[model samples]
Target: MHHILFFGDSLTAGYGLKNAKTESLPALVQQKIDADKLPYHVINGGLSGDTSAGGLFRLDYWLNRPIHVFVLELGINDIIRGISPQTTYKNLQAIIDQVKQKYPTVKLALMGMEIPAFVPGSFAAEFRTIFRKLADANQMAFVPFYLAGVAGKPHLNLPDMLHPSAEGYRIIADNVWPVLHGLL
Candidate 1:
């Protein structure tokens, strides 16, 4: 079976849900893979409040496995912490580099995030474009804003409004599926 790793923060982890294994974006995607009879195993590598730098630190562990596809959904945490856009970019680049080095033929994908509306225009603009820049630089598949329609839609999120609810995860899974399917 092919392995597709979904690496990200709490949003990808299905935080606050009663059962992340069944309600998380990765799990939902796995369900789709099964339903469509696709030969792929979805691995959830998300952690609550994980930043790109944090992901870089732990990525080697995940790389120990045979990964055919890697979907990155990081950077938001870094942004939330007021990390420089340049720093976030470097960390994400390092993460991608490690994956490419380990699995030269791996199909890579980037799940983009948008900076909150109130952030400074320059910083917001820079932070927002990191994924596209990375995708273009690495020639990886890209999902522009996985939470597009669901973000800020209070009903779609948990009470914190920072993490997606089960319903929101379902929408994200649908958003990610088309690009992920194309990678196969």
Candidate 2:
């Protein structure tokens, strides 16, 4: 079976959701795929609080199987933790490189995240450019901003303002569906 792996941090992991298995982004995507009778299995490779560095370290474990589509959604935690944008970029690039090496035919999709306005303007801009740069370099599908419509909207996010609520995830799923659908 072909697999579509949603690899990322808490946002992709559905951190604040009460029913992650059914409400997480990946699960929601799977539901759509199933409705359309697509032959694909959705795997959630999200780890809460994980950074780009952490993702790089754990990538091998998730690479053991054949992956048809790889949806990369990391780097937010690194940005939030005040990690250097260069380091995050390098780690993310390495992860993409490794995935390509292991699964040459895998279709790639990058989910971009934005740093809050509180972050330094230069750093935030640099961080924002990384995902698009990577996507362009690799000729992969890209989502300009993963939290475009959901971020900063209290009704769409949990109390902490970081993680998305179930309703928010639904919005995310809607945003991601078109990108993934084209790949499928």
Candidate 3:
């Protein structure tokens, strides 16, 4: 079976959800794989409030597995915490490097995320550019924005408006499925 690893923050982690099996993005993707009868194993490596630095720290554990495809989604918390964009960018690069070294033939899929509108224009613009730059430099498959239509949509979010509801995770799975399927 194909082993696919998903690493990210609360959104990918399905934060606030009582059951990860029913609510998390990896869970939703796994359900799709089963329903479609695809040959794959989906692993969730999300960490709540995890920055790229945290991802860096846990890289060894996840990368040690025989991962065929890796979905990287991080940096939101860093941006929210007002950490330097350059720092976020560097850490992401480090992740890419480590993954490449360990899994030379692995497929990389980047899950992009946008900064909230309330953030200042300059920072938001730069933050948005970070993913694009990384994808370009690493030659990885890019999802543009993970929460495309669901970001500001209240109906799709939980009470905190930060994480997605079950329905919302379906949308994310739908959006990510094609690219992930293509890669595998």
Candidate 4:
């Protein structure tokens, strides 16, 4: 089976879920793939509270096997910690670079985050546009703001108002599936 790795932070990890294996985006995508009788094998390389730099550091370990698709969902944690957008961009770019070096033929997909245009500071704008910039530069399939219908919807999120609940994840998966399916 071809391997597709979903790598990122809390959202990818299914943070508040009782079971990531069955509820995470990767798992949900796997279910969709299975229903379609696809040969892709999904791998969840999600780590809670991880940042772009952290992902870069942990990348090599996950590179042990050949990967057909590599979906990157990191960076929000870095932004939450007030890291510079440029630094996060470079870090994510580095991760992309490493993955490309290891699996030259791997298809790439980037899951981006966005802040409202009204949010103050050049930081918000810069951070909001990083994924687009990266996607354009690298020719990766892009999920522009995967949290669209789920974010800020109280019922969609866990009590903490951060991570998505089980239903929220379903929505996320639906949002991601099309772009991901295209890569396959």
Candidate 5:
């Protein structure tokens, strides 16, 4: 059986939403696995507004599990808070390095986050580059942007416009599932 662990922030947490366990991407991915009769387990390790630094602080707790797949979906909060991109890059690298040291065979997936034009276009270029660089450096699978189709789409987001609605979650699962399935 494959054990997939989702380590992310509000986007993965399904913040300000209901039936999160059933409506979030992690849950949707779980359902897909079940329908396909794939032997797998999905664990939600998301904490709302968690930055890459925060994820590193809690890495030991989640890394304790025998994870076959580890999905890293952080850095958005840090970007929003105007934190340095270098700090974000370092934190992510640390997590990836530690995971590799302990679980050399574990499949690693890095989910990128795009800084919306409205938020500030200056850092978007560098922010987007971080994911690709890390993926290349660590030889891990990479998702271009976690909120690709869901971001900036009013219909797909909740009232807050920050978090995705259930439909949006499906979009996330759609982009993520294929990559994960291939690994499985």
Candidate 6:
């Protein structure tokens, strides 16, 4: 069976959800696949507060099985932690390289994140460019901003105002589906 791996941080993990299995972006995408009668299984590889380095460190474990489509959504934690954008880029590149090296034909998608407006514009710009640059360089599908419709909307986000709520995740799934469908 084909597997679509949603690999990233809490955003992809459906953080604060009462039922992540059914409420997460991966699961929502899986539902779409099911409705369309597609033969694919969605796997959520999200870890709360995970950085690009952490993703690289744990990638090997997930690579054991065939990954038909890889939706990469890391680096937000790196930005939040004030990690250098250069290091974040390098770690993300390493992760992408490892995936391609292991599964040459797997379809890849890069999900971009945006830092809060409070962050310095220059730093945020550099951070935001990482995903697009990686996607362009690697020839992967790119989602410009993962939190497009959900970010900064009080109703869409949880009390923390960072992670999405269940409805917010649904909107996120919507934002992701078109890109993922094109890849499929």
**Best by TM-score, which number?**
4
**Residue 96 displacement (Å), model 5:** 0.8
lDDT of 1 at 134: 95
The TM-score of predicted model 6 comes to: 0.97
Clashing pairs in 5: none
Number of the candidate with higher lDDT, 3 or 6: 6
Estimate, for each residue in 1-184, the C-alpha lDDT of model 6 and write its tens digit: 7999999999989999999999999999999999999999999999998999999999999999999999999988998899988999999999989999999999999998877668776888798788888989999999989999999999999999999999999998899899999988
Q: Which window of 10 residues has the lowest lDDT sum in candidate 5?
A: 116-125
Whole-model Cα lDDT of every candidate shown, in order: 0.92, 0.92, 0.90, 0.95, 0.88, 0.92
Q: List model 4 lDDT by residue over 42-140, tens digit each.
A: 999999999999999999999998899999999999989999999999999999999999999999999999876778999998999999999999999
Angstrom error at residue 142, model 6 = 0.6
TM-score per prediction, in order, is 0.97, 0.97, 0.95, 0.98, 0.95, 0.97
| Model 3 residue pairs with clashes | none
Task: Report the lDDT tens digits of candidate 5 across residue range 28-87.
Answer: 989999999999899999999799899999999988878888889999899889888889
Clashes of each: 0, 0, 0, 0, 0, 0
Candidate 2 to native Cα RMSD, angstroms: 1.0
Off by over 4 Å in 3: none
Total backbone clashes of model 1? Answer: 0
What is candidate 1's lDDT per residue for 37-104, written digit by digit as tens? Answer: 99999999999999999999999999999999999999999988999999999999999999999999
Q: Which parts of model 4 are misplaced by more than 4 Å?
A: none
lDDT leader: 4
Please give the lDDT score at residue 30 for candidate 6: 98
Residue range 59-106, candidate 3, lDDT tens digits: 999987899999999999998898888899999999999999999999
